[model samples]
Target: MQSDNPEDQKSTEGMVDYNRNSAAQQQIIDSQAMQIRGLVEKVSNIGTEFRIVDYGCGPGISTINVMRPAIEACRSAHPGEKIAACHADQPGNDWNTLFGLVSGPSGYLNGTENVRTEAAIGSFYKQMAAENSVSLGTCFAASHWFSRALHLYAPNTVWFADLEGEARAEMAAFARQDWLTFLRCRALELHPGGYLLVSTLGSVPDAQEKNGFAASGRGIYRALQVVAREMADEGLINGEILDNFVFSLWFMSEDEARDPLKQDPELSKAFEIDTLKVEPAPLHQADLFADSIGDPVEYARLYTGYVRAFADSTLRKQLFEPSTNSAEDADRLADEFFHRLDGLYRKFLDKYAFEIWHLTVVLRRR
Candidate 1:
């Protein structure tokens, strides 16, 4: 069910059609969205017209639904400056589905601004936003790609490199630079009294031995690699399946959360973080699905859509690699996963809990 409050638009990243398998993730997204909106509402320009821009807007469903209240409130309070919603996301993002949101009767925006996300560079954004075009900027859950400075989906060069550290450094540089770049771009876009709000999946590590996905922080991906490799050895799947998928995560101990900006000195130097709060909320497992279940496999399928979706992707990749056919075979695989999931539930009921780092950091444009 969509949220009753329209302000939910500010935190709509996780609502993408990417097949969230884990029901647990929805709560996290909802919690983080609320935090982001709460922080955004506190921005000094409450009375000012908002040129709202959703940085890294995913499907736009969540954003459109969540930001509704803000739009209506602003419309009620001051209608002089129209509400302009600028949605900036990656190049191949599903725009038809994303922008199609505007056709809805209760769309959260009065205007739509869509910009292809640059892999690392931020100059185009600066130019697209123009000088001082935005009154408010919002990004949620998507900043981690830049925060960790990971590789792009497709970089023009396709060159090979053997140095892992150099690659990591490059990724980090890209992340930090792009983060600062958006902040700069938004800063220039916002009027003197404008504000910017950003919220991403965050974590402050603790010694409590909480669950971090399973197997490893990269449990699903690493497990997929293992499963894929095994299937490949058995001549059941393609060896190149690995390149088609990528997943990454980051963790900062609670101490690190004390000053969230410390992770990126360059970004900190460029953008001043006015408010950074790291709050650990209990995983409301029941809130994830329409109804809760004790079985872990059912839990994964219903409660952990985010993780379950990834696992399903890997399984589908294995079945479809090189050759594709057999609707019956696909059905069989689905049945097998659910059946095995039942067994796995009996295997690790106590350790199945997923602990995510809920991070909230707001940066003012420099």
Candidate 2:
């Protein structure tokens, strides 16, 4: 499957073809922020000193934010107690950003030891000091992005490229690997009876739901394929549709989480998903998406609003424009693309209404 791996914000080449401000991301953060607090309350290591690993704690904002409440609650329930919180992210993750998240304690939290923060890349997966020592573990919306062994290429490479099929395949595989890795690691990291709290953006199955969850992947890909063909016909972009480009995402499940990850022999029996529970994480801030937004036109408007909210309008346009030489031009182009995208979304909304699922899975390590 084709993959466009953007490692964090800046690459070695110093290209910035991405947007930093993300409202959907912020919405996700806000939604999960509270349940994470509740997960902290469920943990009680009465006599033992506490240690935790926020598995796949991307960039550390979620981990540190969750940790803050946990630390305070721990103190309140067991007054004058010294608790230690460990924020874990892959070594390849952005540490500087994680550092910034934890540096500010803001008097609401005090008396908790930082417990020697460590970055765990793949090698860190080998072993850790927390051998069955962790009291609580949470992978908030980040487990499904892990690398896996079941890397299979779909049959139709040409069709895949023409339709950005590779991207879909990659995201699907990513979804699988993330669940497997999270459960497998949960088995190894948590002590018996400890809980693993996981939350993620999940795909709903029905055509209407799917069209709703990812309306743009297909429409946008169609447009790009046409553009690629046109450019190639005119002696530009080498007319290569098979180049690296794809669309994919793993979505919500009511039952799959009950038995999601494929059972691999390499995974220890002890490190299995002993019990799984899934429920929809409802959206509270309707104002973020409009209270009564259902019309085809309104859906398109909301969809485009979402894209523009997440992306810098200017950078997206640069992909097609010859004069897109500077960052300003790129932003302008992105804006235009999103402006036109409202029309594209209208096409999808006319056919199907989407159901975006926020999934929370509770895994008990075997």
Candidate 3:
């Protein structure tokens, strides 16, 4: 069920060119393609039709890429079974671009017979399809998002890892609840023998790091904080707004991701863990920075675009838009903010890096 609170209704839909700018996310998906295919190959007892749902499938080629291997494996494993590629995301998602890609040259539908596409428009934290219907479910780079926009005050930082004291504890508790809700919803949608593959941003324990933890996107969030503070200092936004601003997402550690399944009797009885692991994710744009001989100008443009793609909508609604009355004022401030962020990236190219990690897990319904 959707939240009634307006703040909670804030959408995390990516910018229009999400596919082009989300190369790092694409890399995470690509790294696990073999594993996805392997799991599908092992799937048995599928009915006359095979249904594979991509939950939180943002608009892009990433979803297409993820579905291809599984589609092929399904075909090889269960010949003559019709295939259904179901894509699920928030209602505000760019469905046009998604469908465009689905019918485009690179889509799984290309030259493939006995296959059809579907769209399930709603939160993945709720049941997306009928019970015992989904054969294989996959969610990539999106499960970290909270079902609602949290109103918690995170005065020190814009990222969860830097949140301190009560803020941190509250965020962790909320994350745990959201994770279990997601698992329960998936349990309802999947068949008894269905397979679920999820890969999202994650964290790891590090004694040398602050809070004794290190997480993906830390540098990016720090850069965001610095740039937002600069804007606030210039009177573009108020101090209170800056202090309260925090991304409504969490990057869970490996143990945090596994705890519920290990501790909850219901989850333990509902599903069996096939694989759970965390690995460092490569930043494709960073590699391009190296190839460009550390060209700050080009690097900054690329990195800023990458960040803006996923974050622009949220920042606009939660920060910039709320700070001003006139739409034009909000637009101007947003443009200026990105401009300054780009300049900061250029000025401190070496200091800011998207050092990200990914948690990949495969679970089978019991």
Give candidate 1 misplaced runs (Cα > 4 Å): 1-16, 19-29, 32-49, 76-79, 109-128, 146-185, 207-270, 282-291, 303-305, 308-352
- lDDT per residue as tens, model 1, 1-366: 122232221212223245234233334455555544554454444333466666666554655543554454445444454565566665445566655665555554345333122121122234446566555666655554422213222121111111134543454345445555555556566555455666554544334423322111223333334444454466544334433323332333333333325555654554566777555545642122323346555655542345444344324432332223565665554455445444443454434344444555556655
After superposition, which runs of candidate 3 have C-alpha atoms over 4 Å from their true positions? Answer: 1-8, 282-290
- Tens digit of lDDT per residue, candidate 3, span 45-160? 67657899999998868899889998999888888889999999988889998899888888878899999899999898889988888889999999999988876788778888
In Å, residue 25's CA in model 2 sits off its true spot by 4.0
Q: Which stretches of candidate 2 lie over 4 Å from their true place?
A: 1-22, 44-48, 78-81, 105-129, 148-178, 207-244, 247-249, 260-281, 284-288, 291-355
The most accurate candidate by lDDT is 3
Q: How do the predictions measure up, each by TM-score?
A: 0.61, 0.61, 0.95
- Give the candidate order by descending TM-score: 3, 1, 2
Clashes of each: 25, 19, 0
Name the TM-score of candidate 2: 0.61
> In candidate 3, which residue pairs get closer than 3 Å at backbone N, Cα or C atoms, i.e. clash?
none
The total of clashing pairs for model 2 equals 19
Candidate 1 vs candidate 2: the lDDT winner is 2
Best by TM-score: 3
